[model samples]
Target chain A: MILLAPWELLLLMFANFFSRATCMTVGPRSSMGFETCYCLSWRVAVEANNAQAWRTVPAQCVLYVENYMLGGQYNKDLDVVIEQISTYLNGIVAAGDGKDAWVLDIDDTCLSNLLYYQGKRFGGDPWDPSAFKSWAQRGLCPPIPAVLRLYSRLVQGGFKVFLLTGRDEEALGVSTAENLHAWGFVGYERLILRGPAYRGQSAVGFKSSMRKQLVEEGYRIRGNVGDQWSDLQGDFIGDRIFKIPNPMYFVP
Target chain B: MILLAPWELLLLMFANFFSRATCMTVGPRSSMGFETCYCLSWRVAVEANNAQAWRTVPAQCVLYVENYMLGGQYNKDLDVVIEQISTYLNGIVAAGDGKDAWVLDIDDTCLSNLLYYQGKRFGGDPWDPSAFKSWAQRGLCPPIPAVLRLYSRLVQGGFKVFLLTGRDEEALGVSTAENLHAWGFVGYERLILRGPAYRGQSAVGFKSSMRKQLVEEGYRIRGNVGDQWSDLQGDFIGDRIFKIPNPMYFVP
Candidate 1:
C-alpha cells in the first residue's frame, strides 16, 4: 500500500471534496411524480468521469479547483515525475554530441505560486491582474524543488537551458529575473518571456515561434517541460516533453 | 461539501487502492548506466497519466483505484444517472406504443457485486474460478440502488425490463434469479444469460445475438445500460445507452 502521511490523507480528502461537489445542482427533480435529489445528466457525467480509465474534467469544474497544489498528492505525483525526467535527461545527455538545450515553462513548473493560490482560495475569486503583478514584484515565489534540482544539474552538466514563459517581459522583466535569482535558480542562457508586441497572442503560437527562433539559432531543444498543454502543443516540442501536473486552473 | 459516511469513506479508499497499485513495476532500469528506481517508461507514463485531461490508466495503476465507489461519491453520482435514465424511459413511454423494453447489463448495472468486490479486495489476487463460482452460488448480490429504483418504476409504468448478463445460464441461472428476487425484483419477461453453446463467443457477439432475438420477437428496446464498452458496442444498441462506472475490471 502507498503510505500516505496523516495530513496527506486529510489533504486528499480535502482535494476530492472539490471534485465531488462538481455535480451538485440545485433543486430536486420530480420524475413522474418521484422526487429525485440530483440532476441526471450531471450525475451521469460525474459517475462516468469516475468510472472511465481517463477523464478530462467537465469544462465547468476547471475554475473551481480549490486545493490541488496545497495537497501532498500533487507533490508526491511530481516525485515520480522528476525521477522519470532525470532518467530521460540522462539518456539525452548520453545520446547527444553537443549544443543540446532544454526548454522550461515558468509558472507552476519552475516557480510555484502556492501562497498566492492559497490567498485566492484556488480560483474562487475573479483574477485581479494588479494583485498578481504585485505578488510577482515580491519575488517571494519559490522554485519547485524537483524542477530546481533538475535545472541546476542540467546547467552544471554543460547543457544550455532556456526559460520560455508566457509572462510578458515588458510587464515582468526585472521582477521575473529577480524571482528566479531569489529562489536559487540561476545561470540560464536566456530568460525569454513574451514581448509587449506579442500581447494577446495564443500561447501555442508564441511558444512555437520562440522555439523556432531557438532552433534557427542552432540550439537543439532536447526536452521541453511544462504544466499546460499549450506549452507543449506547438511545433518544435523537442525530443521529449515532460508535463508537470497543475489541475488548479487552466491557462487556456 | 458532499457528506460521506465513515464506512463509505473507507470503502471509497479501498476501491481506489486497486487502481493505484497496478503500475508499480517490478524492477529498476539502467539509464546510461545510472540505475533508476523504476521503469522510466512506466514512471513517465505515470506522470503523463496525471498530466492528461483524460487518460487510459497506465497498465500499472488500474488495480489501485483509491476512492472511486465510496464516500458518497458513487451514490451522489448516480442521482444524475437515474435522472437521465428516467428521462429516456419516459420519452419512450411517451413516444412509443406498448412492447417497449430496456436492456440492462447485470454486473455493476442492474445488480451490484459490491460485497463480492469488497470481500475480494477489488480483484487483488489471481482470479480463482472456483472461488468466484462459490461466491456467485450464494446468490446474495444486491441490486444497484439507482438502477433498481429506475427499473421498478419503469416496470410498474408498463415498460418491459430484460436482464442480459454474460454469465453462463447453466452456472448462474438459479442463483441470479434468486438474487434478483431477494432484492424485490420480479415479473421481467425474461432473464437472459449466455448459454453453454455461446461459451466461445465475444461479449458483443453474444449480446448482439440476444438483442437480435428480442427484436425478432417484436420488442422495441428503448434503452440499454452497462458498465463496459462491449456491452453497448454492437448493432442493436437500441435507442439510448447509459453507461455505469466500473473501472475495476474491463469485461471485454
Candidate 2:
C-alpha cells in the first residue's frame, strides 16, 4: 500500500476523464479510475513537454510535439527514492548471493516524455497520439537523472543488466537501444519488448506473465525499479521497492 | 566490456579452478589468467577448501534467506542508470502503446546458499551437495542490503516486480515466501520454478530460454537483473542491465 503524491492523484483524475471521453481500450482492470486513466495518460503524456505544463493541460485534447523534444527534471523526491534503491541493492549483493541482477521497467519508470502533453495549445485537451509517434522517432528526450546513475553503476559493478520495457515489439532494435544509449545509459544484454495482444485482447497481466517466465529460467532479480504501480506487482526476487514521484503525469 | 574489480578478479580465478576440476566446464573468457591456471586452479581451490587447515573460509555466496535474496550495493552510478530507465519508460507509456515490466532471476542472483558451503567448515576437500542442501534447509543466511532497498523503492514506485529464480520446483510454499519475507524481500503474484530435468538431463541455455518464453507471452521487460551471466544472456525486453557484485562465487 503506497501513497500517491498530490500531482499524481490529480493526473489520475484527469486520466480517468480522458479515458472515458476518448473511448480508449486498455488491459483488464477496467473496473475504475486507475486503469482507464492509466491508458489515457500514456496517450496524453507523450505530448507534454514539462511537469508544470502537464499540470496546466485539460483532459480532452493534447498537442503534438512539432520538433524534437528533450530535457526536464522530475519532482525532487526522485533523488531520495534513487538513494534508497542504491542502498537496498548494495545490501542485497553484499549480504545475499553475490549474483548479478536488477529489475527495471521502461514506461513512466524509466522515461519522462509523458510530460510533453502539458499546457500546450493542442488539437484539443489532454494529448494526441499522432504527435507522439513523431516525437519518439527523434529519441532526444532526457531521462530521470537518479535512475540513470543506478543503471550505470550496476553495469560498472559487473552485474548483468536487463531492460524490460512494455513498449511495442516494433520498437526493438535501433530505436530503443539508440534512445537509451543517447541518454548515457548502457549495459543491457537483452531488451525485452511487448508482444502482440494475447487472447484476442490487450492486458496488463502480460508483464506479470513474462516475469514469471523469467523466473523459470533462473535469474535472481535483486532490485526492481519502476514508476507505475503495475510495474511493481510481479514476483521480483528483491527485498524492497524504490518508487519515484511521477507527479507531473501518469500512464497506462 | 565491464571491468572486474580487484576482488572480483580474484574470485573468478578461484571459480575457474573449481569449475574445471569439479564440472570440467569451460571457463568464462573474462577470468584472469584463463589459460595457464584454469584447470590447475579448479583442483587447487577445491582441494584448498577441503584441506583441514582451511576449515573457516569466507566464500563468495549470495545472501539468500528463504525467498528474497539481496543484490548488492548503492552507489552513484546506479542512480544515473535508473534515471535513464525512467526516461525511456516515460516515453513508452506516453505512447499508450507500451506496457510496464521488469525481469528477474533466481539461484545465485536471488535466493542463494552457496556461501554457506564456502564459509562454513564442511568436511572433506571438494564440496558436497548434501552439505549445501543442509545449509539451505537451515535458513541461517541474510539478505543483500542494497538489493533490498532497490526492491522496496521499486515497489514503492509502482512497477510490477517479477522474480526469476532457478530454484527447483520442489522448493516452494512457506519456505519460499518465508525466506523472502524473513530476508525482507517481497513476493510475486506468479512464481516460476525449474520444472523436472529434461530426459533426466538439465536444460541448456538457462535464463535465455525463459526470457524468450516471456516475450512470446507478450511482456516488455524494461529492467532485467540477475547475478549470473546467463541471466543477462536472454532475449527479453530490458532496456538496461542493473548488475550487482557476486564475488562470493559462481556456478557452472
Candidate 3:
C-alpha cells in the first residue's frame, strides 16, 4: 500500500531522474567506465552525506570546488556542504564504540597542498618538486574543507582524532603540528607521520605497514578518510573508509 | 712457543684487569642488553645532543626529534645520527619486500609531547571528558630528541617509515601537520590514527582491522617504535617493536 502511494511514487521518480541526470552529466567528460564509476561514487558520497536522496547534491558538488577549483570563484552555497559533512562525521562518531575511536591520514588529504599548487604562483606545471619541497618545508597549507569539518565533528562528538600523513618524518615535528593549529582544526589525540621502516619499501608500502602497526597497538580505526587510494589501503574490513575528492590532483 | 711468553702473559693480565675496572664503572650501564633496554635510554637521551654515541643509536630516535632536540640541544652531533639511521634505513628499504618493515609512533617516540606535560596543560585528566576535549583543541606540542635524527637517517637509507599513533580523527587536518612542521621531523609515508568503527569496535579493534588492510595493500611491518606499548600491538610477526621513554608521563 505504501509503495503504491502517490507521494512514494513521486519520490521514486525524482530519485531515478536525479541519478540519471548525474550520470548523463559526468559521462561525457571522462571515459565511459570512469564516468560510470564517478556517477556511482557521486551517488554514494551524496547519500553518505544527505541520509535522504540527492537533497544535498548542490551542497556537496560545491565542496569539490572549494577543495580543487578554488581561487577567484567562491561559492557561498558551500555552507550547506560544510553542514552536511559535519553531520555525516557526527553520525560516524556517534556510531563508534563508547570508547575512543578515530580516523587518520596525511599529505594533500588533510593538509591542502593549495600552497604547493599556488606557491608555484600557478606556473611551471602542477608537479614542481622544488616548490613542493619548499612548500612542505614551510609547513603551511589550508585544511581541506570536508576533512576539516569531518574531523571537527568527530572530535566534538567525543572521539579521538588522528592525522596520519606521508610527510617526511624529519619535517613533521614542526610543519605538521603548526599547520594543524594555523588552520583551527581540533580534537586530534596524536599525529602519526612516517618514520623508519625495513629497507626498500616505498611510501605507500610504509603506509600500509603503519596501519597494521596501529592494529597491534590496540586502537580501532572507525572511519579512514583520505584522497589517495593508499591511505585507505588496509585490512580494516569492518570500518567505513570514506574517500574525499582529491581533484587538485592524484598522488603516484 | 705458541703459548704466550712471560711478558705477553703479564700484558694480557694487565689489559684484562683494566677492562674489568672499566666494566665496573660504565660497562654495567653500557652492556648491550641493559643499554638497549633501560639505563642507556635515559642517559643517552640526555647526552645524545652532545655525545658522539648519538650517531650510533638507531636513526628512528633522531629524525623523530630533529626540530626540538637534534636541531636544538645536540645540533652539533646531528650529522652522525643522520648518517647512521640513513645507512640503516637505506638497507631496509632496499631489502624489504611487501611482507616486512617497521612502524614508528610519532608522539613521544618520534615527536615530543613535552609541552603538553610541562605546561601541565592537558587541561584535565585523560579520563576527563572536558579535559580531553580541551587538550584536543589546543594541539600544540614539541618534538622529542633522537627521533628527528632517526627519521632523517631512515628516509635517506630507504627504510619505509610509517607513523602510528592513537590520536583521534578530528585532529588529522591541522594539529598533526603543524606539530610535524614545528619539529622539522620528516620521512614518514603514512600516518595511522585511532577513530570510530562502524561495526562498533573500539579504536584498538579498528587498528587490528587496519593490519589486514595494509597487507592487502602490499607491505608487511618488520618493526615498530613508540613510547606507548599500544602503538605496537598489531599482528605482523618477526618485526621488532621498540619503545622509548615518555619522561613527560605515561598513558593507561
Best by lDDT: 1
Evaluation by lDDT, superior candidate among 1 and 3: 1
Candidate 3, superposed: residue stretches over 4 Å from native: A1-68, A71-99, A119-126, A198-200, B1-252
Report per-prediction Cα RMSD to one decimal.
13.8, 22.2, 31.5
TM-score of each: 0.47, 0.35, 0.35
Output the number of the TM-score-best candidate. 1
lDDT of 2 by residue, B87-198 (tens): 5445543123334457666444455544573454222234455766566655555565445656665565555667765555564434655677787677443555566652
Task: For candidate 1, give the DockQ.
Answer: 0.07
Interface RMSD of 3: 36.6
Determine which window of 10 residues in candidate 3 chain B has minimal summed lDDT.
B46-55
Across residues B166-210, which tens digit of lDDT does each residue of candidate 1 receive? Answer: 987998899999998999888787899999989989899999999
State in Å the error of residue B33, model 1: 34
Docking quality category of candidate 2 according to DockQ thresholds: incorrect
Q: How would you encode candidate 1's per-residue C-alpha lDDT over A106-220 as one tens digit per residue?
A: 9989999877867765545556678888898777888899899988988888888899998879878889999999887888889999998779998989999999999999888
Which candidate, 1 or 3, would have the higher DockQ against the true structure? 1
In each prediction, how many residue pairs overlap at the backbone (N, C-alpha, C within less than 3 A)? 25, 169, 121
DockQ of 3: 0.01
